[model samples]
Target chain A: MLYDVFISPFAEFEFMRRALIGSFALTIGAAPIGVFLMLRRMSLVGDAMAHAILPGAAVGYLISGLSLAAMTAGGLVAGCLVAILAGVVTRNTLLREDASLASFYIISLAAGVTLVSLRGSNIDLLHVLFGSVLALDDDTLLLLAWIATITLLVLAVMFRPLLLECVDPGFLRSVSRGGTVTHLVFLCLVVVNLVGGFHAMGTLLAVGMLMLPAIAARFWCAGVGPMIAAAAFIGALASISGLLVSYHAGLATGPTIILSAGVLYIFSLLVGPHGGLVRQWAPGRHLEA
Target chain B: MTFALRFSDLTLGYERHPAIHHLTGEVPAGDLLAVCGPNGAGKSTLLKGIVGILSPLDGTIERVGVGPREIAYLPQAADIDRSFPVTVYELVSTGLLREAGLFGRIGRGERTRIEDAIAAVGLTGFEGRSIGTLSGGQMQRMLFARLLLQDSPVILLDEPFTAIDDKTTSDLLGLIGRWHSEKRTVIAVLHDFEVVRKHFPRTLLLAREKVAWDATQNALNGENLLKARRMVEAFDTAAHACERAA
Candidate 1:
């Protein structure tokens, strides 16, 4: 029973192994970024940026017929454009960041849908919208691994300024001119992770992989370091379990992984340590008293 | 002492509508000055201008001896998000950013300084605690600990005592006294007239413009105080663009 449930799927099928590796790479690369997004209260912005990349990916698909490099380049450009445009609108106009983001993301999503329909069949559109984790090629797996490596290295180097940015942006501004540069670099990291995630899990559900694990981790840990670690671990566990479920139950692979993460998020919300519902309702909730 | 700051016909505001208009003043390097004003009289605006967060609409603010890094500013409590996940130690250590740039190592000496700052602010054992766990007074103390580590020559404080208890206020006031004794230039925005009268030696009474810049007793006189209120009330809300003469 244990072999069938956990071990045999990976032991028997090459596709399951590839899917598991792809999901693991994505969790390692994107989960910490999600933690920052949650801390900065930009989880919705992450979702918007995810959708904003769709039109660009569609255009790339039209130009190169679903080539990985072209689609990634296109998605990167689209994600960055939306992020920068939203920032510019917030700075120059009366519209807040969320409002501007909302308008731009809707336009991007509509354009993406229209563009995909113009050139591709229903099957192609489904693949683009929902991703194909079980069919990850060697090149795609390598790309995911490289993105994960770069993301972790850059995050480690930029950790201090990024922490300061989330905790006290005003203080960061007072001390150094690096505040704006740090912010821009952070946005670039977000775009890169989103594009990479789109390759593994489709644009629609990529942000789910980024956000759900991070938020779930928030309920488990109080410190930023611990929260990020917890998020990565939860993401990896969800990926493994989700791949197994998809193999056994004949479910769609990408969303199965994200649904697994969602399940963990719900569990964390209910009973995880930091500020879970159960903890809040427990006796002697206030330690000072 | 040298001149720390000189504001020559400085106008500070948003969208060309001046909140502080044509104000000229000089702050001696070590002078402890209190900025007292009625509502909308632009005390906070002046501090923002000094900290280089807000640019002047007209004229220049010349800094004589102090560099940008040599000035520390404490904004109002409303400007900070206290729920951010950071320990008291980590937040206070950020004050050493000037000495230890982005990726520089925090030497033993720097660590000692951070600890000393925490101790000075009465947060010695609370270094490991998250800032979100701190009460209003405790958070304020943590901020002061950061400021103590900053060790800047010029300190601009915007209503530091607001929303804090008397004990916290008095304890922080004692730190301010220590700064004065150490000959650090201190410019503070204060609302309590009694606190100003008792503690502050110099006062700048402001009402959209300078009402009086003199000794605390002279600046807070009944005549000047009444004039300040009247001037602020009568100030035009729909003023035109400032026309600088050739």
Candidate 2:
């Protein structure tokens, strides 16, 4: 009975193993990018970029019968376009950064819904929204591994610039000539990671996982290197816990992962030493006091 | 002590419209020179150009004490993003970057210097506190702490005394005096004639074109003061221009 119920559902399953590997890779690879996003206060951009992939994935699926390949390509194209447009508008106009992001998200949503409707997908599109852990296959798992490698490589190359830019852009400009190029490259990596994470975590959960763990890590860390490491650890833990819960309880995986990350975020928000909620619960929330 | 800075035919502007045209100036070492100018006279631009924050359209800016790796830049407190949740220690550690050299590690020696910088700025135990919670005075002091950590021979300050209480301003002024005594060349972009006369032995009076790049406050006569006042007022007016119109 135990074999039929618990062990068999998890151990005896190939799809489960693929899903496990994909989830682990996504969690490990995408977390450091989240720390930067939170530091830059551009968590909303991650959300918009995640959702921006939907129309691309939908359109690709509509045109081609292949599921994972078409969606990834389509998502990348859509996300990059939206991100560039947002960046240009923000740079050109006097509008605040948040306002520009909001405008871009609105446009991307409109475009995605229009295209998705055109694709005439009557099937459960939870893979794009909530993500399907069970649907992961050997091929998709291999692609996810590549995604992890590329994400880590891009992050490792741009890590210094990304941290500097996030902490003090003026200092970066004052220091080196390559600052502009490095910053643009980092943003491109952000777009790619958002797209890569979308397959397992879904748009909402991808953003949630990216931001929550990093925000939580801020309370525990003194320096940039430690913060990045802490954020990655938090992400990996949440992803593992989420997958385990999803497997044992027969619940959805994406929301479960996000919930775990979000819970950690709340813990940090409330109990963190520096910016923690419980610490700042009083008027002493003001750092000076 | 030798000459601190030399700007040779330095022209600076944004995109197309030139702000300061063909300006040449030099400062002797150990002198606090207040750069006073009329609004749109490019005082900030000049500061930016000399300090290598903003590249000049033409010509060169060379400084003696400021090596290729050493500089202490105190940007206007308002210009910094105070809303960020970084701790005082984290913010101050950035000053060590010049010595740490981007990818270089922050060793024990660097850590020791960071503590000294914080103490120099009179905020020793406040390292754990978040930067966002500091008052305007405390915030400026934190900036000073960071500058102290840089340990550079030349310090470039852009309107450090703006929008603060008289007490804080005067306290900072006294700190500047102590800094000057250390023989570091200090270039302060300021408006108050009283502070300039009391602190700076040299003055650079500018009006888009270089009007006076001479020594002593005596050069800042009534006419120069009038032009400087106009420029400073115009800048003060232009900043909130949108609200003033409404």
Give lDDT tens digits, candidate 2, residues B1-246.
Answer: 368888888888766445777788678787788988766788888877766766787778887856533566766543455555568888888776656654687878888888888887778888988777788778888888787777777888889988778877887788788879998788898878788888888888888767777765565888766765654322232232122110
lDDT of 1 at B211: 94
Model 2 residue A161 CA deviation (Å) reads 4.0
Model 1 CA deviation exceeding 4 Å by range: A111-123, A284-289, B233-237, B244-246
lDDT of 2 by residue, A4-115 (tens): 5545655877876677677777766677777777777787777767767677776776777547788888878877777766666765668765787677767877887887
Q: Report how far off residue B121 is in candidate 2 (Å).
A: 2.7
lDDT minimum window of 10 residues, candidate 1 chain A: A119-128
lDDT of each: 0.87, 0.73
Tens digit of lDDT per residue, candidate 1, span B1-246?
478999999999877778888998899988999999998899999988998878898978998667665678888753456778888999999888776776789989889999999998888999898888899899888888888888898998999998999998999999999999999999999999999888999999999889999999999999999999886444466876668651
Can you tell me the CAPRI class of model 2? incorrect
